[model samples]
Target chain A: MLVLKNIGVTFDGGTSIGSTILNGINLRVCGGEFVIIIGGNGAGKTTLFNVISGLLRPTTGQVMLDGKDMAKIPAHERSQYVARVVQNTMAGTMCNLTIFENLAFAFTRGKRRKLLPYSTSARRKIFAEKLESLGIGLEKRMNATVASLSGGQRQAIGLLMSVLAPSKILLLDEITAALDPKISDSVMALANKIIVAEGRTTLMITHNMAHATAYGDRMLLLANSHFQREFSGPEKEALTPSELAKVFGEV
Target chain B: MNTLEIVSGVEIGLIYGIAAIGICLTFRLIDFPDMTCDGSFVLGAAISGILIKSGCNPWLALCAATLGGALAGLATGIIHSFFKISNLLSGILTAFMLYSINLRVMGGVPNIPLIGAATIFSGASAIAVLTCTCLTVVAIFTYLLATDFGLALRSVGQSKGVSTNYGVNIRLANAVALMLSNALIGLSGAIFNQHQCFADISQGVGTLVIGLAAVMIGEKLFPCWSYLLIVPACVVGSIVYRIFIGFALHSEILGLKTQDLNLITGLLIIIAMAAPKFRRRSC
Candidate 1:
């Protein structure tokens, strides 16, 4: 449901200093497809997500979602179609607000914000039901400040928040990288469950190769700012971590 | 304190609290230590005073003051966002320009009086603190923070990158957040002018410091789970801080003259700023 055509982004440091982050990169994801992207630092994985989310304008490219060109759309306007979870735990949620309040904000995404009085009763009920489905016991603490939450709990909330809006696309940028392994497993499991249940298209970036192979339906390795290899279906299932690393020359 | 004194204290406290909440929103959420509060507060008073003197409705005057403060904040946001200026410097620049703007608004005078004017709090007593005007503003601010747009504003303050990823336009959100913050401060200024019967340009000189003090005190007192509680805590804290200052002024043993208000305020800020450091070390 998403396609990027020759997306290129360049940053100018000074008159004599300039760098290209992404060079004519092309990618596509169909509906209900979960794509795992693995890359080293500065491989333009995040930049690719940023371009798709309308946070950065490609110097020369077109981003189309479900066949609609989003080149002219602003970031806030694109929220109705794309939802993103960032690398920082604090970035995924408002630390100062309660879980319910953050969820309320997500519920009204892409709408004009106004200063109206809020009644937490209905919001609490909805959040509680959603939290119960995750079996995380977060429903009981709807009024708790997000800052007080553990990293895993926060990530779960972040994942739930991304899918709360009726958006067609979800971007996960190292979301579980900050959590402990056990917590990360639960979160990944939850992510797989939600994506499959909702039939939403997802693009997840991870540094861990095990997670890349274990989670998504397809995996692609990014090298030197370009897609170097693609693995999927039985081919992905048969590939081992060591063999995958050998192909990328890290073994 | 007598009922009359308590009523007066509460009214004054509520006004300062409103301004303090605005300061807290920008400081804590947006991570912008905005000094525009000082100029915006005075600008609010000046604009409201001028409009009231021209026979405008008190409500309309208040609206003009809020818009004036919003414009000042917008100017600061534009400077910071477009020019990549430091947040503090941008606030300082806007505040410095507002001094002259406020002067012009008051026709070169430093103060304006509203001796016989009708204010929203004209007939409000201790029991009637939640007047129609107060209720309306509270409702409006509460709604603004609860809405999706408000969430985007909070997200921007939390993390610029996350906000962008959420499809929230950081520039627009920052601009609107600053405008709303300064507008609230302006509303307080309009209320204060009517209550005090005069608006002095010097009244806002230490407004930012006062706001910081209120926020610090509120956070210490409430320490609640919900973000919305910060709003009322700031209101209460402002009044409590003022009451503390009033007590110090009235105590014969302290020998603190009323004119030494600025000195006391400065000292209070020093104590407040140091208290956090001490707590961190202790922990």
Candidate 2:
């Protein structure tokens, strides 16, 4: 479970030039719940993710992850409990390294890395099996550098990396935004399958109306630096993309 | 060049080649352009020279010198990681501080003579000893880079954010890398002191430039995308660079002087760095 209480972020706080980006934002995410967030430009969705992930310390808030106050925990340590996939495909993986190397990195998440040899043949076989299951055709090119992969492939790898290791929560920030619609659909379906299978508590931010309506057990519209609307259960299931878009335009 | 000059060139090359590997660890492996080589190189010499002069064991002196260099690297890492100073500035400050520390370690002297001192190279042919030492260093580094910790360190160098997201302590990895890197440079300095029978204050003047030149030249010549070959390539690069310098110095028709060595190294680095760009353009 993840809980954000009285979360607020102000740039240059208490100064004449101070500007509040997020104010009095509160949210609670139960375990195994898939939550989708929709917002227009600069609605502080990514900022909220940043605050939770410890990239930026909130000006004021208590981030409770499974009853632990994560305010003082640094980003690297926080990652043991929180995994994330960034919007920029390139930002999620090392481009110069082989795909196998990137996966090796993910495989050891939350574990102490020692002087042992990295990625035995058996481990490579396991990685290849995982990739094959994704149907991404990346199993054969495990040694190839990630720079040669397309955007959709990279995003899929990013998603795979987040799920490779267990964490208290997973954050996906517009991970499929850069992919073509067909690839995006498959990636989203794959993400949905993984999250459901793993029973992971996930928060995904998107601008797509259809993705907003189609996925996630709960949907939230973030506007004016706060949760303007939240839809769940039968209401979320019955919500149409056109109706969501109409409400999205009003705010 | 005569056989003796060429052989001595390789002997010197083998010793400095260890330093080149250190440069490779920082500049290539982690993409950290560390300037601590200039100071840590002399720090090693100073530590080993003073310890040897005080009747300490030669091998122990070498180890202490390496530890000193690791500490110097730690200083730079702490300053950069904790204080949020720029990476270049962190190395520069550490190197600058080390200048005075090196003098103090040498008992306020600018140089120390190691003549008649029982060094590790005392009972052996300098070339054979240096060659063995260089190969061992290369092997150790090759092994180290293939480990899980090496992957973590490399990831930190490639992308800090992604490394952080994957639970890598970037600051810690950076510090460890700098420590390992400067430790090798320091060891090279200690060996150089034994090789030359003296340790001068200004002996490390162009150490970073020389190591960088060797690394770049090695990559340009071999062009291996694998990490396994890159470590050995740095040593090869050093030997080649030294041989070329020997040839240049010996050529009477070229009319080049010993003072031009730094200028030549600078020019070589420029060409090596720009070579890739030119190749990319042609493609």
Candidate 3:
């Protein structure tokens, strides 16, 4: 479970230009809950994820991960508690490393790194099995450089990597936004299945309203630097894109 | 070549190979084309020469040299990371400053002579049957790289975002990588000073080019997927590159003087840089 209590983030644009990105925002995700956040441009959605992932520290409140205050933890130290996928496909994997090597790195996440001499074969086999579960042909290309992977393939791998470690929370920041619709659907379906099967708590941000409605158990909308609305179950299902848009004054 | 010449060439090659591996590690794993190797190379030599002349043991001198290199690298890493300086600029600035630092370390000398001091390769064949020894060190390094920390460092080079997502301390990784890289370079410098019986500050000049050349040559020759093969190939490539340079300098046909070494190095770098482009065209 994760909780953000009365979080606020302020930016000093200049001596004269001061702006607050998030103001008194509160959010909670129970264990095994899937939360989709829908927002238009500049809705502080990504900022919220950034705050949660320890990329940005909130000025006013605390970020509690499993009841521990995590606002002071550095981004790299947060890997043990949170794993995230960014909108940029290349942001989630090392492009120069082979698929299996990347997975090996992921498997050893949140641990002290050492130099061990062993053939990558054993680890490659394990990664292959995991890849096969994604139903992606990445299992066969364990030795392939991530540079050669398609955007969708990379995103799928990124999703899988985030869940590879036993982190308490997974953050998806429009991870499939760059892929083609078909690939996007496939990646989403895979993510849905993986998150559900693993029973991992997830907070996914999306530009697509339909995805917000269809994928997760809960939905929240951001506007004016705060959560403007929250919906769940049948209420979230009954809401249409136009109605959702109206709530944010987009319609 | 005669056995003696072959042995000498191989020994020299292995020494350079160690430096090349250090250079390649910073390049491939940290994604930084760190030029501090040039200054750190000389720094190592200077430190080792001073210590050895002062009656320090050869191993202790080598350790001191490695530490000196690590400090130099740490300085460069701090300038780059904290000051938001570009990688290339950070290396260049640090290397430039190291010229003065090396001078201070050597008590204002342009070079230091080892004279009768012992070296790691002392009593070794000109053919340097030290391959087995070098291989052991290489194996240890390779194994360390396969560990989680090494993977994190590699990830930093590959993708900063991903590495951070995995909670890899990028700044720490960068610092450690640079330190390790320069430490190895320093070790090579110490060895080189002992082998030649002298350490010249100018020896570090164009060292980065030599390292890049070795890496380029290794990738060209082996072009393998495995790090085990690629790492050794880099060492071999460094030696081969050195041999070719040495032969070119020694050849009567070239009519080149020792003072023209920098000119020759520059030309070699141009050729190396262009080789990939030429290969693309041919393909």
Model 1 chain A weakest lDDT span, ten residues long:
A111-120
Considering lDDT, where higher is better, how would the candidates rank from best to worst? Answer: 2, 3, 1
Ranking by DockQ: 2, 3, 1
Candidates sorted by TM-score, descending order?
2, 3, 1
Residues A1-251, candidate 3: write the lDDT tens digits: 89999999888844478888889999889999999988888878898988888888777889999899996789999988898888999888888888887788888777666656323667767787999998877888888998899999999988888888888999999987999888988898899999999998999998776677789998988878898888987898898877776766751
- Docking level for model 3: medium
Per-residue lDDT of candidate 3, residues B136-170 (tens digit):
65886777676766677778888788888887888
Give the per-residue lDDT of model 1 (tens digit) for B133-188: 45566656666666555666777777666566556677777787799889989988
Write one digit per residue (lDDT tens) for candidate 2, span B56-107.
Answer: 9988998999999899999989999999999999999999999999999999
Worst 10 residues of 3 chain A by lDDT: A112-121
Listed per candidate, the RMSD to the true structure in angstroms reads 3.3, 1.2, 2.6
- Per-residue lDDT of model 1, residues A71-107, tens digit only: 9998778988998888788788877777887787777
Q: Any runs in candidate 1 off by more than 4 Å, and if so which?
A: A13-20, A114-122, B1-11, B54-60, B111-136, B146-149
> What is candidate 3's DockQ?
0.67
The better-scoring model by DockQ among 1 and 2 is 2
